[model samples]
Structures are given as C-alpha cells and as structure tokens.
Target: MPKTAALCISVLGTGNIGSTFAFQLARTGQHDVTVIARPGSTRLQQLQRDNGITNHRGEHAELRVAASLDEQQPYDVVIVTVLAHQVAAVLPALQRSAAKCVLFMFNTFDPEQLQAAVGEERCAFGMPFVQAHVNEAGTLKATIGAGGQKSRLSQQRWVAMFKAAGLPAVFEPDMPLWLRCHSPLCVAFESASVLAVRRGGGASWQQAMRIARGVHECFVLIQGLGYRPYPSSKKWLAASPAWVLAFVLWLLSKNFTFRELLAGGVAECHALIGVMIAAALQTSVPVNVAAIQAMNPTA
Candidate 1:
C-alpha cells in the first residue's frame, strides 16, 4: 500500500467495537473502510440503506458495508472485533483472506490459538480503549478511553495507519501478559455486578470485599508464574490496602452506568473467567481464587 493512497481496511463484526471503529475510520476519510457483517443482519441493511451508522452524539458518516470478506480484492488490514468466544468461528474465513495483516481487537486469556489459526507473521493483537454499545435504536454510544487512545501489541504499519487516522496507538510489549493480568480484574468486577443482581439491589460491602480479595489473589498468582502484572496500574490491587480497594469497587458497583454495562456483558464476563481460571490452573500455582470461581460455579 502506498503512503499517499488510502488504506483499504475491512472491519469484521458489526458490534459496538467494530461499528465505532468503522465510524471513526470513515470520518477520517484516509481509508477505504468496509464493514463486514453476517448475511441477513438487519444492522447491516440499516447501515447500507443509511450509507453509514450513527453514534449516540448524533455523529454519522458514509462508508461501505459488506456481508463477506473479499478474497480476490485484498484489504490492506482486517480488524476482527467479535467476542473472544466467537473468534474460532471466523478464523477460517480470515485465513482465506488476502489481507496483509489481521488484528484481533478483543480480550482473550489465550492468544496462541489465534496466532496458530492465522499464521503468527500475519497476526496482530490490539485492545480497544473505547466502551461502546448499540442502543435499541441501533445508534452506537461510546466513551473513548483517554481521548481515543488504543493499545496495540506492536509497532507496525497498521499502527501507523491508525495514528494517521487520528486514533492514538501505543505498543504494549507484553500484551499477552497484559491481557492475562487484566482478565481477573475485569471478571471480578463484572462478577460482583452480577452478584449485585442476585442480591436484588446494588453491591453490598461484603460482595465488594470478596471481589477485591479475588483480584488480589490473581495478582499474586500472576507474580508466582514469573510475570510482573502488565500495565502497572494493576499493581495497585496488590499494593493498596484491601479495605481501600474494596471501597473503590463498592462505589463502582453502585454506579448506574457501570451496572448497566456490566449487565449487558454478563455472558462474556463468565466466559473470560472460565478461560482465566483454566489458565491459572495450568500454572500449578496454588492461588486461592474461590471468590472468583464462585461467581460462575458451572464454569
């Protein structure tokens, strides 16, 4: 791809993350953005008819929408933003595409399977810093973290492309570890939120302490496995007093906005917890994750 010519980017999955990305790319007009959704998807039809998708702030842009990946006309980059549990279903399709780089932009405790599916050379990993959701009206309401900054696993051509489009991108050298460390904290809070639902109201002090303890254990387990918690911010869980952290968790759990988001992602949260627990067990590190495990007994 030429520096001056627009990059051909295909965003697979039409969920909150994918749609938000596609919208941002379209607004930049520096790339030929194509959004691929499953056939028979009403969202795809709406996007095609309207020539774009709208955001909660009423922002909109015209962009291409497709139902399948174009094998013959290769894309410069293809971003996969589906749920982690759903990644396997799309691997074969992505492997058959001629796109030079395929970026997986979702959470997963294990990335080896993805790396194996798409040849490591062509695989890239990224995590969206934005929190977005599709409302009933189908408009995307998103809160871009740190003013639209995103984290990538490496510095590559795709990173340059993202930066050129006004999306700040930073390279995280230990991304796999980053994701692993992140999983526990994410699962703990989300699990606590679900527990709140079971309790028939907001999060209680006991539930908050349980989550804080669970997170602290995860941090210990990560260290026992010979890896420093990636993203130093997580180190706080280990460094801070238990009561302090629990208080913070309690406050977050009571927030209406946070509860709403957690409610919508309960399924994904459970799946991630299962994967994280499995990974921890494999390390043979005697870490007590009972609080976390109790969140999803079936898993």
Candidate 2:
C-alpha cells in the first residue's frame, strides 16, 4: 500500500476503545475516518457537535460521524471495538458492509464464532493496549502506548495503518491463544479490584493471593485444554510460586492508576470469565474457575 494512499476506515462503537482509536487515526489525516454510532444516539450527536474528539490533555482530532456503514462505498477496514459480549449485535451490518477487512479489537475467548459470522477471510483479531475511558463530557481520557509499547493485531495492513497514525502495533501470529491466555489474568485483576472496592479499600494481601491463585488455575486450565499461553511471559504465572505472584499483585493494587483501570474493565472482565469457563467446560477440562465465577455471580 502506498504511504499516501488514503484508506477509508470505519470504527464501530463509540466507547472508550473506539473513540480513542478514532482520535488517533484521525490525527494522521492520511485516511478518511468515519465513526459509526447508533442513529440519533447522544454519542453520535456529541461527536457531530464537537466535530472531533479530545483527549484528557485537550488534544483534538477531527473525524466524521456516520449512523451506519455505507455499503455503496465500502471502507478499506472496519474496526470493531465493542465489548466481548456486544460483537454479535453488529455482525449483520459488518457482513453486509463493503469493508475489505474487519478487525475485532476486544477481549474474546470464542473467535471461531465471530470468524464464522463475518467470514474467515475478512475477519481479523486485535487487542488495544491503551487505557482509555469516555467521560460524561465526551472527552476520551486515554493513555496510548508510547516508546516500544504497541497494540496487538493480526494483519499487516492494519498494523502499518496504526503505526503510521502514531499508534504502535505488533502482530500476533496466534491471537486466539493470546486472547485466551489473557482472559483469566484480566478476570483475576478485575475480580481482585471488585473485592477491594466491596471491602471499602484497595486489595488486601490476602485478596491479592486469591487473585494470583485464580490466575495460576486459569493457566493450568489453558494447558489442560492443549494450548500454551501465548507471549511466553504468561507462562511465568504458572511457573512462579503462589506467594511471589501474590506479592506482585499486592504491590500493583496499591497503584491508583491500576485500580482505576480495573474498575473500568470490571464488566468486560466478568463477561470474558463466563466465555472462558464455557470454553473450558467444552474441553472436558476439570478447571476450577469458581473464583472467577464468584467475581460477578449475577452476570
């Protein structure tokens, strides 16, 4: 692809991840970016009124807002940044769109279902590594990756696009396994944080220990299902003694930033835990996910 060739891109959803990505991509000014939001939704009106999105520091990036994907003028790429449980709602639109590629950038343990819904050739997978949230004022508070930090994606073109837009991207050959491995760690962190909040304070050392143990079990379950945790570093969770991992979690819980991130992601974490537990059950793996399950029993 030519560096100057403008790619038409559409972002589905107006949540933190979607808004943050749109802001970054719009800053490049090389691509024609449009955000697809629900018709007559407040977010759509906000985006249209603001004529752009602003970051926490008040940095702005102009973008186009649309009510739906235009089948007549298909986008070069459509990035889905909805929560794991919300992907199904947008499948019909994506399937009918003229987009050449559809990148799912969220946490999910069931990629095969999404692939089947969208067609394997057009479906791609990625995970945004930014900490972002949309405030009541519609400002996107985001801490995007810098230096060597980059988000994970599976396609070359998408990776190049993100990098060119100043958002670093790294390719993961086995995204499904990568996501599967990451699911439990995310659940554990959120569960610990929820427990902390419920207890009216940050995570205690004991709560951190329980979270570490939950992560260890999840890693074991992944191995039992005949998949090695991707990125290799996660293998350390299984390798380290429970006490050491607990100490690390305890230390991390003290950080205000980490706690805030956990709070924001608790809902998605609960959803993913359900998916992971279901996946484990299908494999006849007698995994102990009670800790994760207990995180959000009402869900």
Candidate 3:
C-alpha cells in the first residue's frame, strides 16, 4: 500500500493573527508547522525564545517557532495569512515552493488575480469567522468559526484539528462572500469610531455601538444588493435584531480590552467601509445604494 502523506505546513506571516493561527495549528498536532516571516526579523526570534507557544492561557503549548522555507521540506499546505497588500510580494516565492496546496485566509475582492498567480488547483480560501487583535502586551487573541459545511471534506479535517486545539473552527459556504460581508461592516464601524476619536466628539463607548450598528447596516446594504450574504456567519450576526446588535455593541465597548485591541485602526476601517458602499452603489442592489446615499449625502 502507498504511504499516506504527512501534512507539512507553513504560515507566511507572523503578525498577531498569524501568530494565533500558528499557535493553534501547533497545538493541534495534526501537521508539522513552520512560521515564515521576513528575513532577519525579530518576531520570529521572539517566537522561538518564548520556549514554545501557549494558548487559552497556557492550556496548550506547542514547541515550534518561525523558520524560513529553505530550512524545511516542502509543505503540503502553505497558508498565506499576511496583510492583504503583502500578498503579491510573497506570490513569486510561493510559486517556487514545493507545496501543493495553498490556502489564503484573508479578504480580497479580486480572487481572479490570485488564482491566476497561484494556479487554481493549488489554492483555497480561508474565511475567518471571529474577530481578535493584539493587546498592549502584544498577545494574540481570536475566536474560531462555528464550523459549517462550506469547506470540502479535507478542509474540514484541517479545521477540526484547530477545534481540537481550543481555537473555534468551523466550515462554511461562500467563505469569500462571508469574509467580505464582515469587512464592510467592520470598516464602517471603524470609520465612525476613528472620526469620533479624532474630532474629540464621541466617547469610545458611543463609537463602538455606532460601529456595530454600522456593521449591521452594511449587511442590510448587502442583502439590499440581491446577493444573499454568506449563509452561516450571516445567520449568526443577523440572529440579533438591530436593538440586539446595538446592545451587543455597547456591551463590547464596556470591555476595555475589546476597544484598545480591536478598535484602533481608523484608516483601514474607512477603506473597507468605502469599498462596501461603492460596491453597493455600482451594483444592481437598489436598496443598498439608496440606503448608503441616504445615510451619507456626500455619496
């Protein structure tokens, strides 16, 4: 009988999100993991010296650290979890690697460009269902998806491994659309929060609630466009009425950790909001376009 292949994996970034993913993967014991960061970078060094990483408050520890692709064998799955803009620079390196399966766990409106670059057979999209960020001490914190049936069987196996490790993992359908749906709303809320912070107008608590409401509005705009929001995450977020969403927002704001860690990126928040609004305006979704225009006369 032919031997089954082992899962060799590499994460292409070491930011807060990437670190959390790597830690989760290591804890799972499903794959041999490597973290790929910029050459001569200190993040990798700190990761190594941490004497194995831990998650869920040291509930699990996996003794692996960042390494270059050159030091390791070819990966079975190369997960590219870098910043959206950093994807292109890593493409050529990825193309040269021996990894057969490449998964992108990020937001990109243009999938065609990436597919063309990596070849369709080698690529998959990973849509993150929960939100998290680094605290003042730079610890990575995030929640995993609820695990739906959106991904293939093999993909489910990978997600299950993370779930075993204590990070929530789930499969879902239309992950890209799901990812996009959240981005717009997140961006909108970020916009309001940042604006308030800069103008010295709204309190942080008020801004957080407004942004949560804004996120709901983005989804409303999306449904207005006649495209059904990705089924699973939408169901979770949409389960709450506007009052609930607003209430949740207020609750999240009261927690200082949520605001300091997750709510500070004003520029990014604005760009995402702009994209969602522009997409609505340009598309055939009359209700979304009208809603956006109605809310923002500048549009």
The candidate that achieves the highest lDDT relative to the unseen native structure: 2
lDDT of 3 by residue, 127-147 (tens): 554455544443566555533
Q: Which ten residues in a row have the lowest lDDT in candidate 3?
A: 290-299
**Tens digit per residue, CA lDDT, model 2, 1-299:** 23546778889998888998898888764577898888888888889988878877878888888887776677788999888887777888888877888899987777878888889999999988877888888889877784457899988778888888767788898887788888877776776666666665677877777777777777877888888877778887678897787787677666676776676666777778777777667777677778546545133
RMSD from true fold, candidate 3: 6.0
How do all the candidates rank in terms of lDDT, highest first? 2, 1, 3
The CA lDDT of each predicted structure is: 0.75, 0.78, 0.58
lDDT of 1 by residue, 176-246 (tens): 77777787767766776776665656678877777777777777777877878777688766778777878
Candidate 1 deviant stretches above 4 angstroms: 1-5, 56-59, 145-153, 196-201, 239-241, 297-299
lDDT of 1 at 88: 78
Model 2 steric clash pairs: none
Going through the candidates in order, what is the number of backbone clashes in each? 0, 0, 6
Best by TM-score: 2
Question: What is the Cα-based TM-score of model 2?
Answer: 0.90
**Superposition error at 6 for model 2 (Å):** 1.3
